[model samples]
Structure formats: structure tokens, C-alpha cells
Target: MTTKVLICLYENEVCPRFDLTREVLIAVIDRDAAVLKEKEVVLPQASLEMLCQMILTEGIQVVICGGIEEEYYQYLKWKNVKVLDSVIGDCKLVLQRLVQGRLKSGDILVE
Candidate 1:
């Protein structure tokens, strides 16, 4: 089986705020922990509503992001997306940890 994980991005790191994110990195990981595919999606603009729509439309199963609003967080959860919020780090490191099954919400990987 494969899981789709979306990481809210700012340059090469996790965006500090979810609603302000304009870019996202999506990865498809398989049961063996190998990334089957990866893609970067640039939104037309930073809008919470647009982002939420993209997340659902893209079939994202997991979300890795920083500082999310309670309403949005709860909404995603209600939709069955696993949100790993409050994460701060290099996107590569975050992805590595995720593939290893160790990534978590509130993770601070930057020094």
C-alpha cells in the first residue's frame, strides 16, 4: 500500500505557519518505506481555503506542517487526514523521519 504525505513548505524548510504557506511537497511512500514519487505544488496564492481544497483534492493522507489554526486542524482531522503540525526543520529531514515512521507533531528538527 502507499500513503500520500503532504508537507507545507517555505523554501526548503517546513513553513512556519500553515495559512501562509504557498508551496507544498507531496510524497508517495510505500509499505517498504520507499518514496514512490515526489512532487512540489505551488499554489496560486496563500489562502487557507485554497490549501484545504488542494489537500482534499490531492487525496493527501498525511499532512506535515507548522502552526495550524484550530479550526483548520480540526477540519482536516474530521476529514481523516493525519496532521503533523508544529514541525520545524529541513524538508529533507522531515521526509526522512516520516519514511522511518518516526515523524511526529511538534517536532523541532532545526537547531
Candidate 2:
């Protein structure tokens, strides 16, 4: 099934804190896991509510982020969004792993 994924970014890397992130990468992928479309979104300010709103409005099915708070994580889950938290790596590399269905929560890929 096709899905939409959002990744919080900071300086081309996974943002260390989801609540503090101001930029995000959103991708649309097909059933075979090929990326169909991708874009970076820059927010004027960091707001957890804004982030959640964007994810829902954009039809994001998956979220890749680092250091997300328990409340926000639960909120996303309640909304039926799959969250992979505590991931640390280059944004591109993270995307690759995600596409391969190999990425998991709490994964650290920094080298």
C-alpha cells in the first residue's frame, strides 16, 4: 500500500528533538516502497501542535523523528500515525532504510 512519510530534519540530518524541529521532509511512496514524491517543508517556528496538524493535513502515515515526547508520540499514535522515534542519521540515509522497510524506532545510523 502506498504511504506518506514525514521526517523531521535539521541541517540535513534527523533533528535531535522533534519539538524543536523547524524543518521537515515529506515523501510519498508506492506499494513497492519506491519514492514517488518528496519535499522539504520549513516552518516559521517550532510548535508541536503545528507539526501534528501538518502531518494529519498532509495525510502522513509514518513519522520519523528523534526525541519525541511521550505525549506527542501517543497523540500521533491515537491519530493512527506510525511513529519511528529516536532515529539518528543523515536524512537521506534514513529515507533509504525506510524505503527498504529496514528502519526501526530507536535506530542510530550515524557513522
Candidate 3:
């Protein structure tokens, strides 16, 4: 099985605020945690509604992001999406940790 994950991005780092993120990195990981594919998406604007819509439409299984509101957090949880919120770090490091199964909410991977 494979899991699809989306990481909200701000330049090369995880966006500080999910609702304000305009770019995102989408990746597909296999059961052994090998990355199968990766894609970066740039939204036309920063909108929580649009983000949520994309998450659902893309069939994303996990989301890695910084600060996220309770409503959106609960919404994703209710939809069976695993959300790793309050994560602060570079996108590359975050992805690596995620693949290693070492990532978690409120994680700070930066020095």
C-alpha cells in the first residue's frame, strides 16, 4: 500500500500557518516508506477552503503543516486524514523524518 502526503510550504520550509500557505508538496510513499513520486503545487491564493478542497480531491492520506486552526484540524481528522500539525522545519528534513516514521505534531526539526 501507498500513502499520499501533502506538506504545506513556504519557500523551502514548512509554512508557518496552514491557512496562509500558497504552495504545497505532495508525495507518494510506499509501504516500506520509499517515496514513489513527488509534486509541488502552487495555489493561486492562500485560502483554507481551497486547501481543504484540494486535500479531499487529491485523496491525500496525511498532511504536514504548521499552525492549523481547530476547525480545520477536526475537519481533516473527521475525514480520516492524519494531520501532523504545528511542525516547524525545512521541507526536506520534514519529509525525511516522515518517511522514517519519526515525525509528529509540534515537532521542530530546525536548529
lDDT of each: 0.96, 0.95, 0.96
Ranked by TM-score, top first:
3, 1, 2
Off by over 4 Å in 3: none
Which pairs of residues clash in candidate 2, taking residues 3 or more apart in a chain or in different chains? none
Given candidate 2, what's the lDDT at residue 108?
Answer: 97
Off by over 4 Å in 2: none
* TM-scores for every predicted model: 0.97, 0.97, 0.97
Q: Give residue 6's lDDT in candidate 1 (0 to 100).
A: 96
**lDDT digits (tens) for residues 1-111 of candidate 2:** 788999999999999999999999999988696999999999999998899999999989999999998999999999999999999999999998999999999999987
Position 71, candidate 3: lDDT? 95
lDDT of 3 at 22: 98
